[model samples]
Target: MSRGFTLLELLITILVIGALMVWAVPSYSSVSEKIKMERLAKELSGFVLMAKSEAVMRRERLWIHIVMSGATNSSGDWSLELTDRDTQGVGNRLLHLSGKPFDGITLSNTYTSDQISFDETHGRPKSGRISFHPINASTDLLEMRTYHRSAIVRVCSPNSALYLNYERC
Candidate 1:
């Protein structure tokens, strides 16, 4: 009896494995991208909530500055920098958050100003949406929204086809 597989059988197995890999690789890459976006969204939402709470607890306003990078001013890595709105001489940095390198995620927001601020009285922020997605792909968008009357930040997906378990925006 043969101890090992024949040449034909080995070739067939190799072909099948290659086919499966071809089918799975792209899906895996896509899922990974979505996951990255989701993670950033969640983190952003949490930070916004933290800023709101800190604003109320400290009885002071807070500003989250959005900094963008890249040549065209729209594609590359971005970060959130938290600071007190009342500080002078740029010495009151509280928190800073940035994504992992090479993720190629870009940030866009609907804020009327470059910064998102929380009120000291009620911790309510100006209504706006902050979004994170891949550099050139919009299908994997994840958004964090703040309402004018609520301190809670909501994370959701605008594109429902990405198969993320988050609520729809």
Candidate 2:
């Protein structure tokens, strides 16, 4: 008799592998989406901190413009551009991060007023004294939904306080 596996054993092995994949694929995808969302949030926070520091050091009006555009199918690109405008009335002395979107993520809410422009001297934009969310009196939500995946980043501004709420959608 052959020492190798019989036909029956081979079929069973294939079926077991298929079953394992059916259970693992969805979980893996979910985890991946979560990781992407977290990474984007961290990047945004870092950029904000960097802009603030630069403004303070240079003593100039450094602006961090957060722009989001595109749809879920188009792989939307949102970027943070840092520009320094001095008292001389010059516009955009420096261009930082020219609108780069996160990997595996498409941006939505283009008209959702998600732009958060902040200057070192003025702190945040005209919306309120705080940057992020929960500062503006409007009920407008700055929500960033991940691509084909199931994840969302809801930004709310209340009482000049910015809050980011991350949840699986």
Model 1: per-residue Cα lDDT over 1-169, one tens digit each: 7598899999999999999999999899877776777677768888988888888998988888776653213344666777896332264778887755426676778876457888999899878888777776877677888888756678888878343667787
lDDT of each: 0.75, 0.46
Worst 10 residues of 1 by lDDT: 68-77
Which clashing pairs does model 2 show?
A: 133-156, 133-157, 133-162, 134-156, 134-157, 134-158, 135-157, 135-158, 135-160
Clashes of each: 0, 9
RMSD of 2: 9.8
Worst window of 10 by summed lDDT in candidate 2: 128-137
| Candidate of highest TM-score | 1
TM for every model, in the order presented, reads 0.76, 0.57
Query: Positional deviation of 28 in candidate 1, in angstroms?
Result: 1.0
Number of the predicted model whose lDDT against the real structure is largest? 1
